[model samples]
Target: MIERFRAGVLAAALTLLLTGCSAVMVPVSPADSSGLGRETVRVGIAYDSAGRGDKSFNDAAAAGIDRAKQELLIEASEAKTQAETDEARAEALRGLAAGGSNPVIAVGFLYATAVGTVAEEFPGTLFAIIDDDSVTADNVVSLLFSEEQGSYLVGVAAALATRKDRVAFVGGVDVALIHKFEAGYVAGVHSVDPGIRVDVRYLTRPPDFGGFSAPAKGKAAAARLIAGGADVVYAAAGGSGSGVFQAVAAGRKAWAIGVDSDQYATADEAVRSRILTSMLKRVDNGVFQEIQAFVKGDRAGGKKRYDLKVDGVGYATSNQQLGPYQSGMEKARYRILSGAVRVPVS
Candidate 1:
C-alpha cells in the first residue's frame, strides 16, 4: 500500500510538470486549531509572462497578495505561465482551483479566455481578472482601471519637462489596451502645446507579446526616439520599461516616464535620476479590494471600474525632479476628476 501511494504521488507530480502548471503554495501560518473559529482563506494568482520580478504590473499584483497574507492571514499560491499559450494559463488556473484555492486571481487581461473557461469548470471558486472586462461569469469579477487618466497626467508632466518640445511614447504591444496610454499621452502633450511633436512606437504587434518582456527591443526603441530629438519619452511597456529607463539614462539630457508603478522607487540609482515620473495604475489596490470583497462574503461577481475619482489611477511624484511640474499634473488631475477632461482610450 505504501509503494502504491508513492507511485500515485510520483504520477501526480509528473502530471503537474507535463501541464506546465507551476503553482507554488505558500502557507502564511499554521491553520487555526485553537477553536477560535478563524478560517484562513486560500488565494491563488496566475501571473503574466513577466511574473513577479517584472518590477511593474505583476509586482503590483504581488504586493496586494502580500498585503492580504499579512492583514487577512490568507494562504496563497502563485503560478506563472511557462509559455504564452492559452492552454498553459488554463492549466495553471485549473491547478489552483483544484487545489482548493477559494479565489484565484488572473493577473492580466490576456487570461480572459483562460479565466472564463476555468471559472466554469470550478463554479464554486471565485475568480478575479484585472484589465479585461469581457468575461461575464457568476464566479468572476473584472477589475478595470482608467489607465488613460493616469497616462494623461504623466503626459502633462512630460510636456512640461521637455525642453525640445518633442516627446515620444513607446508601447510594449500594439493592443487596444496599450493604445489608451498613447491616446491620453498625446492628448495631454497637445493640450499643453498644440504643435509639440509626439513620436509613437510599438515594440511588438498583437500575438507577439515579446514587446512586454524584451528589454533590448525597448532600449532600441527609446534610443531611437531620443536620437530623433525627443527630450522626454514615456514607456507604457511592462518589464520592457526598464530598458527605456536605461536608454534615457545613457542619453544626454533625456528623461523617461514609467507606467503601472512608481518605477523611480524601484529603479536602479543610475536610472532613477532620468525617470521623470510614472503613471500609477494601482493594480495593487484593485487586487486587494477583490480579495477583501471575497473574504467579506460579498462574492457577487461583476465589473468594478477604478478611476481617478477613487484614486485608482494617478501619477507618481516620487522623483523630486517632478516638483516643478507637479502643479501642471495636479491641474490635469483636477480636470479629469471633475469630468472636465474626457481622456480618450483609443
Candidate 2:
C-alpha cells in the first residue's frame, strides 16, 4: 500500500510537469530541521565505455553525483563496464528498495532497460533515470535532455567556424536520441547559411553501440567526414569525441565540437585546441536536485523534460571555443538565451 501510494502520487504529479529533480516543479519539504543528518542516499551511475573518466558524458554525471555527495551525506558509486552497469543498477535498486531510499538515480539513458527491469521489480523504490523517457513507471522519474536545442547552438558555432561552409555530425550510435542531434544540427546550419553543408556519419550504425567508446571508430568516422568536405565536425559520441578531435586536428582546417562536457577542458591538449565548443547538459544539477528532494521526503513523479526553457540543457561555456565564430554566432547564442531565438528540440 505504501508503494502504491508513492506510485500514485508520482503519477499525479508527473502529468503536471516533466523530468526528475528540482525541475519536477512540485513542492519540496523544508530542510530536515530535525537536527539530525539525513540518511545516506545512494546514486548509481552506469557508464557504457564512455566510462566515468571519459572527461565527457560519464564524467559530467559523476561530477553531479559527487556534488550530491558533498551537499548531502550520501553514498555513491559507479559501474563502468557493460556487465558492471547491469549488475550495479540491479543491486542499487534492490538495495534501495529494501531500504527507504526514494528516487535512487540511474545515470545515463543507456540504463533504460536495466532501470526498467529493476524499477519494476522494486515497485516501492523510486528511481530517476537520466536522459530517457522510455521508463514510465510512476515510481520512475525520466530525465530526458533537450539535446536538439543544445546541439543547435553548437551547430551554429560549427557553421561559423567552418571556413568552407561545410560541417559534419559524428555520432556514437544512430539511436533516436542521437538522430535528434543530427537533424537539429543540420537544421541549425541551414537556418544560418542555407547553402552550408553538413556531412552525417555514425561511428557505429547499429548493434554495436560500443562505438561510442571506441576512439578508433570515432577517428575513422571523423576522418571520413573530414575527407568528405567537412571543415568543422561536432562529435556527439561520448569518449569517441576524442577521436573526432584527433581527426579534426589532423585535417587541413577542420574543427571539432565536443558533446556532454566542455571539451575545452576535458579534451586532450591537442584535441582541445581544435575544439570549437561543447553542448553543456546539466546532468550534475539534475542529479543534485533529485537527491535533495529525495532526502527531504519529497517523492513526486512523472516525466520531466530538460531543455533550453530551463538550464537543464544548453550550449557549453563558449570560452575560447567560440572566439572564431562569425559575429552572427554570438548573436544567436544571445537570442536563444534571451528568448529572442527559440532553438527547436525535436
Candidate 3:
C-alpha cells in the first residue's frame, strides 16, 4: 500500500511537469545542483486582468518570469486573471500558493487586496506586487515605478515630435493611478512650451476596468482628439491602447505614444511606423530581480522602487525619426535625475 501511494505521488508530479506552467499547477523537476541540489525554487506569477498577451504591462511581468525560468532553472507556475474583482484576484493567488509555488508575484495593483488576504493565509510564501505600494506585509514586497518620470520623458518627446504643437492624452480608467500619467504628461508638454495644448479624456471610471480592454472606446477617444487637431496622442490604456495605435496609423501626420512596454517592437507592423516612442516601465526587470534574489536565499521584502536614475523607467527610441528629439530627452533626463526638475505624481 505504501509503495502504491509513492507511485501515485510520482505520477502526479510527472503529469504536472508535462503540462507546463501556464496554468495554476506547479512544475515538478529534479533539483538544480548549483547550490541547493535537493530543492528547486518554485516561483509563481499572477498576471493582471488583461492577461499575458496585452503587449504592455502583463507581458512585461511575464518577461521577467521567463528570464528566471531560463537563468535560474527554477520551477515556475502561472495564473492569468479573468474577472478583475478582489475575490477572483485573491482566489488566483491562493491557487498558486496552495500548489507550493513560492515567491508569487502579482502583476498589477489590482492584486493588492487579494495578495494581502492570501498572504495572511500563506505566511511561509513570499509575495511581490507590482505598481502598488500599499500592502504592508512582512513577507510581501510592493514593486513600484517612477511612472510619472518616464511619462514626462515621453511627454517631452511628444512635444518635440508634434508639428501642430497640440497633443492629446487618453486614459483607460479615470482612476488616480491613471491620473499620474495624465499629470506627468501635461507637465512635460507644458515644460517645453506652456502655450502647447493637451486634450485629455478617460474611457471609463473606477469599477469599470473594462476601459483597459476596450479598444473601440480608445479608438473613438483618439479619433475625437485627432478631429480636434491634436497631432500626437499618448495612451496608457493597457490593451485598449492598441486602438490608439490604429488611430495614429489612420491619421496621416499623427503620432502615438505607447506605455509599459516598448510598443515599437511589440506593435503590429502596419502601426509600427506611427509609434513615436514608448514609456519603458521595466516591469520584467523588477519581477526577475525579486525572483533572482529569492533563489539566492536573499528574499526581498518591503517596498522595491524603480525610478529613472536606476534605469527602472524611461522612454524608448525604437523609431529613428525621433533622432532630433534624442538630445532634448537626454537633457530632460539629466534635469530630473539631478533635481533640476521635479515630476509630479498628480
**Could you say which candidate leads in lDDT?**
1
Q: lDDT of all predictions, in order shown? A: 0.89, 0.73, 0.88
Off by over 4 Å in 1: 1-38
lDDT (tens digit, per residue) of candidate 2 on 1-346: 9999999989967854543332222243456454223234555555555467888877877888888776675666555543535665566555555555555677677677778887878776678888888878878888777787778777888777778888888888888888878876876787788899888888776666676788899999889888888898888888888888889899848887888877788666666677767888777777777777767665666787767767776666545647666466566656767877665544
lDDT against true structure, model 1 = 0.89
> What is the overall TM-score of model 1 with all chains considered together?
0.89
Error of 2 at 269 (Å): 1.5
**Tens-digit lDDT track of model 1 for 271-330:** 999998999999999988888877666677899999998889988888897999999889
Off by over 4 Å in 3: 1-37
Q: Any idea what lDDT model 2 has? A: 0.73
What are the RMSDs of all candidates, in order?
A: 9.8, 9.2, 7.0
Error of 3 at 345 (Å): 0.7
lDDT of model number 3: 0.88
